[model samples]
Target chain A: MSWFGNSEPEPPSGPSPMDLAKQEVDMYSDLFTKMSGLCFKKCVVKMHGESDLNVGEMSCVDRCVSKYMEAQEKVGVILKRAEESLAAQQGGVGGPAAGGVPGVPGR
Target chain B: MTPVQQQDFLQHLESQQRKDSLAMYNNLVFRCFDECSKSFRSKRLDDGETKCINVCAEKFIKLTSRVALRFQDIQQQKAKDEAAGVQR
Candidate 1:
């Protein structure tokens, strides 16, 4: 999904938008896989006890998803703030080559 | 650079990002497992171990966020010093 959604100011200059979408899907799956494993580790701990998810495990998974998303949100905030601060420090010149802004060269 | 080179560069970046994320995921697993896992006498996890792992994951994420903020502050200060040195 587009992080900016519909509010994107302009098309980003890179691999086509379709590639970006694909990247997003890859990222989502990565997140889902991690969350699934975490919840399994947390809730479905007792594999030998019951073959099916117990009432508590079911609800634990439910809260696990929500709480995982919240954790993602918190982390995203920190990352965004860090990116913004870095960009500002480098005088708004940020990208793959986010070195300090270079002095203008005479042609 | 040529279009082919640009595409290659972008592809490299995407690949690097995937590597980075995977490294991070591995880190979480390592940390939570180290902090939570005690005994492997049985294949099943007990209630206490499960709770420990759950809390460990949450705290690990929170810890990273705290570090990110601290890192950003240090970077900002370093940047300011660099600018000052340039002026001097």
Candidate 2:
């Protein structure tokens, strides 16, 4: 009845390294989709006769993409902290602290 | 590591990746909404909205860092109590 030594063969714990890479690619694809949808909604309220984006619309999409990347970078920092905390909780050890990066308010 | 152990680790990592992706998606949607997409009348972001997006991202980062710092303090306290108890 022991968990680790159960007679039954355990299932694969998770995807292989290759599979992990594939998942990363998939995630990027999803990001692209989300970005396109958001940018379109923000920058293309009306469909003009021309397929090309106007100057204003072009600038908007550019700004949208830039902002998205900025948000993602911020999210990355928070995500690392989240993972560290989760690991610490599970393993009972000291967790990571913020590096106190300057320009990051709420210091 | 044994094959079983390796598999277990991989599974844990997979789940972690899933959680991370979900979090990113949610943050992007909410933060972007707050920054841009204010008026549907125009199909473009104004200068103010663009600036808002930058500030919004920075604010969210700060907020999470604050929470993480709090968690770290609590963990240190727990570790300290455990150490003190051992001395008794």
Candidate 3:
């Protein structure tokens, strides 16, 4: 259905835009797998019956996803600040250093 | 597209994907630690922990949008200065 329609015409014979979209999906799939493995280790202490996921586990998973999104936003903010300061310095604008250096996430 | 063109396009996408994946990985680690790994005694998140996770997420998003607005201001200022210089 015309999802990623661009002004440029479709190439007659090369890797289509669909391939690019597939790559994006693959990247996100990898991210989901890693995030799930990490949260599972951190939150699922007990099996607690044979229902696959207990109530506590389910709640923790929900929180975990929300927290991860938050962390991404925080990191993005910090990164942009850092970039700006670096640019300012290069431009001789003498901008102040980034405030409250945000810690690197995930490692 | 020619073989060279296709290779270049794929290379660009790969680099962008790599950067995104790394950022996601880092954010997940930090957020999980902040939200769920406070106490090692239990794997289950307590109500407090659950609340903390939600709040932490919200706060970070707020901070990000604020910073983005500030960055936009700088970009506009830069553009204005460049335009004035060109007119001179």
TM-score of each: 0.47, 0.40, 0.36
* Top-DockQ candidate index: 1
Best-to-worst ranking by TM-score? 1, 2, 3
The CAPRI quality class of candidate 3 comes to: incorrect
Writing each residue's lDDT as its tens digit, candidate 3 over A8-63 gives: 34446654654654444454345444555556556555322232444665666666
Candidate 2 Cα misplacement greater than 4 A, ranges: A1-15, A92-107, B1-88
Tell me the whole-model lDDT of each prediction, alpha carbons only: 0.55, 0.51, 0.51
How good is the docking of model 3, as DockQ? 0.04
Per candidate, native contacts kept equal 0.00, 0.00, 0.00
State the lDDT of candidate 1 residue by residue for B1-88, as single tens digits: 4687567646755875687668777877776777678899889977877877676666545444433343345435545655575589
Q: List runs of model 1 lying over 4 Å from the truth.
A: A1-9, A95-107, B1-88
Residue A94 in candidate 1, Cα distance off native in Å: 2.3
lDDT by residue for model 1 (A17-80), tens: 4444445545654665566656656765542333345577666766776677667756766666
Tens digit per residue, CA lDDT, model 3, B1-88: 5797667657766776687557655774576455454676777877666655555444434333333343345435545655575589
Query: Which order, best to worst by DockQ?
Result: 1, 3, 2
List the candidate numbers ranked by lDDT, top first. Answer: 1, 2, 3
Judged by DockQ cut-offs, is candidate 2 incorrect, acceptable, medium or high? Answer: incorrect
